[model samples]
Target: MEIEPYVDTTLDEPLVPEPPEPGSILSESVIDELNMTVWTLSNGVTVWLKPTDFKEDEIALQATSPGGWSNSSLEDHQSAVIAAGLVQQGGVGAFSTIDLQKALAGKAVQVSPSIDQNTEGMSGSASPEDLETMLQLVWLYFTSPRQDETAFQAFMAQGRAVLENLGSNPMAAFADTFSVTMAQGHPRSRPLSVAILDEIDLETGVDFYRERFADASDFTFVFVGAIDLDIMRPLAEQYLGSLPRIERVDSHVDLDIDPPDAHIQKTVRAGVEPQSQTIMAFSGPFDYTAQNRVGMRVMAQALEIRLRERMREDLGGTYGVGVTGGYEQIPEESYTVTVAFGSDPLRSEELRGVVFEELRKLQVEGPSQEDVDKVVEGERRARETNVRLNPYWAAQLIGAKASGQDPRFLLDTTTIDAVTIESIQEDARRYLNEDRVVIVTLLPAEMIGRP
Candidate 1:
């Protein structure tokens, strides 16, 4: 007997026509019609709600607090991290870790907490039906955290174990070592040192959670899904409204450490791999800056094109290359462009010279119209694809509004179409000059020959 494949020849209804081209300057009336809705809760927590009538069953909610390692006292920075790790582990209100797990097990509710250079945070998801339970758990986790001493000690031990493992891991060690060589004395350079574990104690964890984490004014709640604003409004008031008042809020500090015009090369052993690559990182402009803002983005994309063409395609020096610019809100928001790849042990300096040559060319002649048009078209296609693929893109718009950006900026083409060849040249001239580049090469100990 022969089996045949079956085809369902059904055709779906067409979608509404795509919006008009966003090339020209966007007007206030056009911006006003953009569908990003935001409101402040009675508890002083700003909430951005985006209603998406997508077909997906699950929704993602990301709520972030503004102060991470940068704002905390160096001693207390890791403490902030410690508190975040134990958020769900130490139990909230009457729910132990096991109990919380059991309550949401089959329902697909997840709560995770993390801390970074700029913010300490918790965010997770629940089914649309469990939104109330999700918010309640988050509120209790933030407000009535137990910070059990045993759990804190266990986590500290785990952190120390992880650091010891990093000593044997080349990639992990590169990040820490290169970060120190790049930013040096700035707050941005501060890594989670192994010594941070020694400094951990029960009292410190409790203090960081109670004195630092409990402040609701510093926190924001973001809910995105098939949400009913009327239903969630009362739930927000009942759960989040009761958080302790924090009159004083944590503020951002700048980490603008412009490195000197020198090449720094170093070598170390990671007890594992004998070979690894180095990363050359340079600071660029923040997203909200004047011409420098979007200019830096175009510049980074242009550099990626050059790097891919010269380093990968032409010379075959490395497997891949990437350049990106993003707004990292604090130690004060700034832009960074990093180029990284594994190197042949002997060709490390040669690779460095090639990189400098490409950057120099960019600074001098500037990119061609063909190059500019390629990136503009690529960026446009990527954005359109992302907007169509992810329903959460709408939620991202709302989150950006809550984070204090004009939501219409996403819909505006001025950022991309306006990125002219001259603009890219100007930004490269400003930020990627000889004095601004910090070249960090991590080679094997034996390969550390003079440049």
Candidate 2:
């Protein structure tokens, strides 16, 4: 038997390239701490380039600017959200979505547009050889985003279909209630519904997308992995440098969204599954600092370890429990700690008490030295491997720039030493507040006889 190598016919006869108009790099800055270089283009686009031989064929890129949909009208939040989403589905430049796919058939290049609460941008990857193609797509997304009515209609139809049956799902009902309750009546925080979907217009989305991406002045572009500075500089200039810009920079606008300052509990009964689920949350104002951020994670990881032991290993109450906690600086400086899990409908209250008792114990007596050390050791092992990788560097590099943190911290392991049992206990006391706790539980609808 003989096997022949596969050939991509599309690649054998490549489509004509749509190269960006020529432009030049205006200036450069070297952050000696991180061994990365930053360049400002003639047209004001900033690029952070980190060269690494981590992977021979890998390059990851992210270009983001402040002023996500929140910067748009809060009343039109759904439209702004849909606009960011439809850009990728609709198409870019002269290519239809299908045409673009066909054109990119054999290229190791990909990119997608996104809009989040405080930022909007593109994130994707390409092989080193396909970097120029990646740049071309980036330029097209900025210059000429196309709209497809068919795609728009299909997207909305699918959305409507999902919303139509959402009321019948216990998890969906619980989530909607949880989100609305936590957001404290913020209009922008409402969950998806037929009414919300009906008010969103594709045309409105397209317009908002254009406005958000219209200017590249405030955008910071990050590229990492297998970088060839000599090769990328000109491509960046030609593609990103030539992007349209007005005399404007964008910043995130807070919609004043925040969780409430009081404790409350609510239960939703739905579904046929004979089970119980609960989300116990604690939140309050926070002082967003580097030390506090790491401390919060240490506390959460330690708590996760405690929960797995008390609720799973010892009590045999359930198979697993989930614990997550983090602080946010945007809109307001605040933090949320959430513990969630499923268990027997009869034992839900008992399990909930276990969680509270463990939390209070940590706050009073602190985690053992072994628990703190485990978290630090795990972080060390992870970071040891992460430092040699591309995506980690890509994220951390951008994060350092965004937070004004010293880039040299990327190499400083001294921070981990600060994670002691005493510190963890102090973090528990400082951050976690039972006064702000919100407990939302879900049980079998028939079991509760319809709450």
Task: In model 2, state the lDDT of residue 168.
Answer: 82
Residue-level lDDT tens digits of model 2 in 45-71: 889998888899999887778788887
TM-score on alpha carbons, each prediction? 0.80, 0.94
Q: Candidate 2 overall Cα lDDT vs. reference? A: 0.85
User: Model 1, 1-451: lDDT tens per residue?
Assistant: 9988996332232111222121111111222444545656555766666555553455567776766555556566556556566555677665556555655557766766656555666677767777766776666666666556676667777888888877666666667777777666565356666875676666665566665566766566556566676776666666666656667767444445544445455664443334558677776445554345567777888988998899888987788777775555445456667778776667766777887888778888889889899878887888776655323564465346445776655666667778878877777777665655566556555444434
Those runs of model 2 whose alpha carbons end farther than 4 Å from true positions after fitting are 1-18, 448-451
Best by lDDT: 2
Count clashing pairs, candidate 2: 0
RMSD from true fold, candidate 1 = 11.4
